[model samples]
Structure formats: structure tokens, C-alpha cells
Target chain A: MMHLPNHWPYIAAAYGLTIGCSLVLGIGAALRLRRAKTRLAAVESQLRHRESSAS
Target chain B: MRPTPYLLHRYANPGQFLRLARALQPWLSTGAIIFLTVGIVWGLFFAPADWQQGETVRIMYVHVPMAWLASSCYLGLAICGLLSLVWRHPLADLAAIEIGPVGACAAALCLITGSLWGQPMWGTWWVWDARLTSVLVLFFLYLGHIALIRAFDEPARGQRAAAILALAGAIDLPIIKFSVQWWNTLHQPDSITLTGAPTMSMTMLWPLLITTIGFTLGVAAVIFARLSAAIHESRTRQLMARSRLNRSDRSAA
Candidate 1:
């Protein structure tokens, strides 16, 4: 086979950065979703409390 | 009346949309990771070096995708903004706000990576090429939308103002896409253009395309995830307001 350019390091760097950033973003978003779910649950429970008290 | 945009309608309902986003995010993120990994491995080690640019040409893998995404992010913003403006969809407004920061980050990444690539090739960290200038404008536009969205005291007013700004700035998208061909600019010709064929070989082209898809899906996952958070936050705020109103009424009684 013919010689390919020895740019493996740069290639690794670029792809690695992409992966790292994407992973951080994905994970961060997931965590946010979980937090939002929790907050929503709290609000729902509070609403239930108010409704039950009124009834 | 024209038929509704099917994809939009299919995913329009907030509960359904949340379910779909939850299902798709993991798979899309995985696809992004897999394709980007394989594409990079193949492009770096397997593909032959360019005749003219030699190793430096490898930067195209990162540069081209970033360049494409930098503007494409704006397009995403505009689409979501239009949906918010025309139909006043709550999800659309949420999407508009959610996508702003992500698009801004993507544009910033593009500029930084492009500058790094340019430093090696173009002999400077910066250039006034048409593509570069338009992309800079795009970055500013993303920032402007983000700021404008948060500027107003009323959330609805802020969203409407941001929607108008987003629609207005969409004009730059086409200018950025065609700037290479239109002007006497230093930016290289588009590897991917509106016309028939690409200038690059199959070996080089496939990886680029795959990575582009990967990047795009990756963007979608991020936007969806962020939008979920925004919607939840909005719901919480509404709950808080109702509770506050109740407390005030009780105290007055």
C-alpha cells in the first residue's frame, strides 16, 4: 500500500474533541431532564396538596 | 389550505414530543459517536494523503463540518423561530430558546477550529474572506438572538422579539453558503455545493458526509434535551405563579 500522511495525531485530536464535547452535552442534557422531572413532580405534589385541602 | 408540515405535526404534541425525544436522544447520540469514530479512524489512517496539501488537508475533516454546522445551526434556529412566530407553538418557542446557546457554542467552535486550521495553511490566525466574515456574522446573530430573547421583562415579549430577529437574520444564511462562489474571496471553493458533483474523491468524501450527519444528529440530541429542560422549567414557573396567587388571596381573606 502507498504511504498515507502521518496526520493520525491531528485526526485523533479532532475526533476526540468532538466526542468529548458531544458526550458532555448529552450527559448534561440528560441530567437536566432528570432535574426537571423532579421539579415537575414537586409542583404536581404541591398542587395535589392544595386541591385536597380545598376539598 | 396547504398541507401542514407532517414531521412538525407528528411531533407537535408536547407529551408525544417528549416521549419521542427521550427515545431518540440515546440512539442519535450513539450514532453520532459511532460514525464520528469510524469516520475519523478511516480518514486518518486508511485514506491516502492529498497530493497538494499533504497532511494539513486532514484538517478539512474538522474544518468543513464545523463550517457547515456553524451556518446550519442558524438554519435550525430560524426554522424553530418561524414555527414559533407563525403558529405560536409553545414547543417551538421553547425550541428557539433552547437551540440558541447550543448554536452559539457550535459557531464558536467553528471559528476556533477554522482559525487553528487557517493558522497552519493561510499563514495567519484570521482572514477577511467572505465565508469567514459571514460565519462571524452568524456567530453574532446567534448571540444577538440569545440576548434579545432574555432582554424583555415578559417572557412572551422576549420570545416574540427574538423570533423577529431570528427571521430577519436568516438572510445571512444564503449569503454565507454562496459567498465562496460569488465573491473574489480567499476562502477555498466549497467541497459540497448546490450543483451536481463534489470535487473530493470518494475516500475523502464519505467520511466527511458521515461526520456531517453525525454532527447534525448530535446537534439534534442536544437541542431536544435542552428543550425538554426549558419546557419543564416553564411548567415549574407556571406552578409557582399559581401558588403565589393563591397565597396572596388567602392572606387577603
Candidate 2:
């Protein structure tokens, strides 16, 4: 097994923070996009249904 | 590539942007995963430790990328601001709104990671050096940008206000870049630059380059994703308002 270097904890913490923040921001953006697209799709489909029924 | 009318002449329209972003996302995300994984693993395990800084130098793989991204993100923001102010591009306003928080996150991480790396090397978690102080200002600037972008009741007014702030905030970026050379600060000078050969070794440089590319891809993915959401939500709002107007006319008739 490879020996770990001194001050490994700091290194670990830094990596953890970088990875964590990136994931949170990335996932949050993806979710917002998903929600907005879904809402837009639902409204568009609803309007389509209403228009067809009216005609 | 910037989404300015100058750069993205064909894809400046939101619909064109959406089609392109959706097509590129899978490739971007997949490439981010691959490069980040390889780069991190190689930097942590295979890359030689700094002859001086030892294993702690591994932090640079992450720290440098965040630092670069934070600065580059702001540059992108300033460009978007210019686009908004000069051309009155609605997409530029939308892009600015989305870039604000992500850039802020990058700046915050750069500060935190720098602190983490500092404790082991500099023997303190914090310092008031020019490089450090300038970056702190950048963090605040990002926070201010985010807040200012949402300050006004009218979105257009808020965008204009934020655009001016972004332009003003850009001054700090050069200071952050040259701080170490200009002052006898505790922070070290840059290892890489466009004008000169990199001081860092080939082994370390490869991983750093890969990681930088990976992080950049990640940023593009997030910003594009957020911009997509904003555009879709705006469309949804317009559709809802039109539907309500049509219903009101029908009832009145």
C-alpha cells in the first residue's frame, strides 16, 4: 500500500469542499431546468387541449 | 464560446441557444466526469509531490482550478454586462442572472480552499496579503453582484444596475493576478502564465491542465443548464399571461 503524505486531512477537506460545492450547484441548476421545463410543457399542453376542445 | 450577438450570431436567439445547449449537454457532462475523475486521481496518486510543499501541493489541483474559474467567470459576467448595456440583449440579462451565483460559488470555494492549503504551508489559516485581500474583495463583489441583480422591481432596471457593477468589479481581477509580484506578500507568484513558460513540472502540469479543462466543462454545463431554465420560465410566464388575456376577452364578449 502507498503511504499517505503528511497533512492529508487538509488535502481531504479541500477536495471535499470543492467537490461538494460543485455538485450542489450543478444539481440545483439541473433541477431548476427540469422544473421550469416541466411547468412550461404542462401549460403548453393545457392550452393545446383547451383550444382543441373549444374548436 | 460566448453567447454574444458578436460571437454567437446564429445562436443569439434563445430558441437557437436552447437547441444547441441541449445537444451539447450530454457531451459536456460526460466529458466533465471523465476528465475530473482521471485528473483528480492522477494528481492525488500518481503525480509527484512538490519537492518543497510535499503532498499538500495536491490541493493545487483543486485550488488553482477554482481560482482560474472564479476570475474567468467574472470576465464572462462583465462581457454579458457589456452586451446588455450596449445591445440591450435580453439573453445577456438572462445570462448575467444565471452566472452570478455560480461565479460567487467559485470565488467562495477559492477562498476556502486557499485557506485550507495555507494552514499547512503558511502556518496560518488566514492572511492579509494583497493576493488574498484582492480575492476576498472578489468574493464580496460576487455577493454584491448577485444581490444587485435582483434589487429592483423591474428586471431591466436590475440588470442595468448589475451590469455597471460587473464592469467596475472587473478592476479587481488584474490586481488579484499581479498581487504577488507587486507586493512582498506571503502568497506565492503564479506557476503558469500565457506569456512565459510554466514553472511547474510536466507531471504536475498535465493533471492540472486536465482538471482545469474538467472544471471549465462543469461550469459551462451548470451555466447553460441554469440559462435554459430561465429562458423556459420566461416563456411560461408569457404563455400564462396571454392565456389569461384571452379568457378575459372571451368572458367580456
Candidate 3:
């Protein structure tokens, strides 16, 4: 097994911060997409119901 | 010759773009994850450490890619702004708005990682050198774009204002790119040149390239996902408004 370098903590901190920030943004965007899709589906379904009842 | 507007109009439709985005999102996200994992693993464990910087050099695998994405994101934002302003393209505005927050996040990452790298190598956590200062400015430009887009009660007005700001802020991109060369800065010059061979060895360069590609794909996936959400939100608002209007009309009759 390779021994970790003395500067391993700094390396870990840098990569950790970067990956953390990126994941937060990416996952946040994904969740927003899911919510928007659900909202749009609900709206469309409501419109369909209104049209069907009217006819 | 075919006019530019003719081509712009062809791809300006939101429905068509949403369809294309749906097809591309899965591929982009998957590729981003695979490449990022490979690049990080290769850079950290497989690549030889620098004679001077040792394991700290591994930070470059993330820092450089974030820096590149930060700059490229602004460029993309400016181009989308131009399309929004000149063509009044609906999708272009959505793309511009969606890119702002992601670009800001990337710029923030670049700054934070650069500071971390500097602490061990430069004996200092921060510097106001030309390259560093210019990148800070880039980060602010992204923030300004994000702020301007949501400043108004009317979304269209906000978008137009933000589009203008994005175009104006584009002047900073070149300054950030050439700051190390233009000024006597503490920062080193570019290691990778477009016309000349790279300064680093293939082992290091390969990981950098992979990470850069991964960052690009990752950014694209996030932006497209956000853009789709923005479109859907707009459609939902329109549908709700129309339904309310219909109810009001029936009551008025």
C-alpha cells in the first residue's frame, strides 16, 4: 500500500470542497427539475379534467 | 448565402430544445460521473507527484478544470445573452438564466481550491495578484448576472436587463485569460498552450484533459436540467393564469 503524502490533508480539503459544492448544485438542479415536471403535470391534468367535464 | 436569423430561428423553439435536452441529459450526466471518477482516481493515485509540490499537485486536477469551466460558462452566458437580445429567442433567455448560478458556483470552487493550493505552495492563503484578482472579478460578474436576472417583478424585464449585463461583463473574460502575461503577477504563465505543446508530461496532462471534459459535461448536465425546469415553470404559470382567466370570464358572463 502506498503511504499518503504529508500534504494529504490539503489535497483532501481541496477535492472535498470542490466535489461537495458541485454535488450540491447538481442535485439541487435535479430536484428543481423534478418539482417543475410534477407541477406542470398537475396543471395539465387539471386542464384535461376541466375540458372533459365541460364536454 | 443563408442569413444568420434563418438558422437562429430554426433552433429557437423551446419545445424542440426541451425534447433534445431530454435525450441528452442522461448521456451527459452518466459521462460526467464516469470521467470525473476516472480523472480524480488517476490524478490522485496513479500520476506521479511533482518533485516540488508533491501531492499538492493533485489539486490541479480539480482547480484547473474549475477555472476553465468558470471562464467557459461566462462565455456561454454571453453568447446566450446575444441570442436573447438579438433574436429574442425564448430558449436563449432560459439558457442564460439557468447558467448564471452554476457558473457562479464553479467560479466559487475555483477560488476556494486555488486558495487551498496556494496555502501549501505559496506560503500564503490568498493574494491580490493580477490573475487572482481578475478571477475574483469573474466570480462577481457571475453573481451580478444571477442577481440581475431575478431583480424585477416582471420576468421579461429582468431577463433583458440581465442579458445586457452578461454581454457587458464579457469584457472581463479576456482580461482574466491574459492577466498573468499582461502583468507582473505572482501566478505562473499558462502550462497548456493552444498552438504549442503542453508544458506538463503526458501522465499529468491526460488526467487534466479528462477532468476538464468531465467538468464541461457536468456543467452542461446541470444547466440543461435547470433550463428544463425553468421552461416547465413558465408553462405552469401560463396554464394557471389561463385557467384563472377562464373562470373570471365565466363569472363575468
Q: Residue by residue across A1-55, what tens digits does model 1's lDDT show?
A: 4554454455556556655666777788889988998999999898999889988
Distance from true position, residue B178, model 2, in Å? 1.2
lDDT by residue (B1-253, candidate 3, tens digit) is: 8898887786688788789899999999999999999999998899999877788999999999999999999999999889989888878888888898888988999999999889988989899999999999989989888998999999899999989999999999999889988999988899998989988999999999999999899999999899999999999999999999998998999
TM-score of chain B of 3: 0.96
- The lDDT-based order of candidates, best leading, equals 2, 3, 1
Q: What is the lDDT of residue B168 in candidate 3?
A: 93
- Candidate 2 global lDDT: 0.92
Which of 1 and 3 is ahead in DockQ?
Answer: 3
CAPRI rating of model 1: acceptable
Q: Which ten residues in a row have the lowest lDDT in candidate 3 chain B?
A: B6-15
What is candidate 2's CA lDDT for residue B64? 94
lDDT for model 3: 0.91
lDDT of 1 by residue, B75-176 (tens): 877887899888777687788888888788778777876775666567787989898999999999999999999998998999999998899999999898
Task: Mark the regions of model 1 whose C-alpha exceeds 4 Å error after superposition.
Answer: A1-17, A53-55, B5-12
Each model's lDDT: 0.80, 0.92, 0.91
> How many backbone collisions does model 2 have?
0
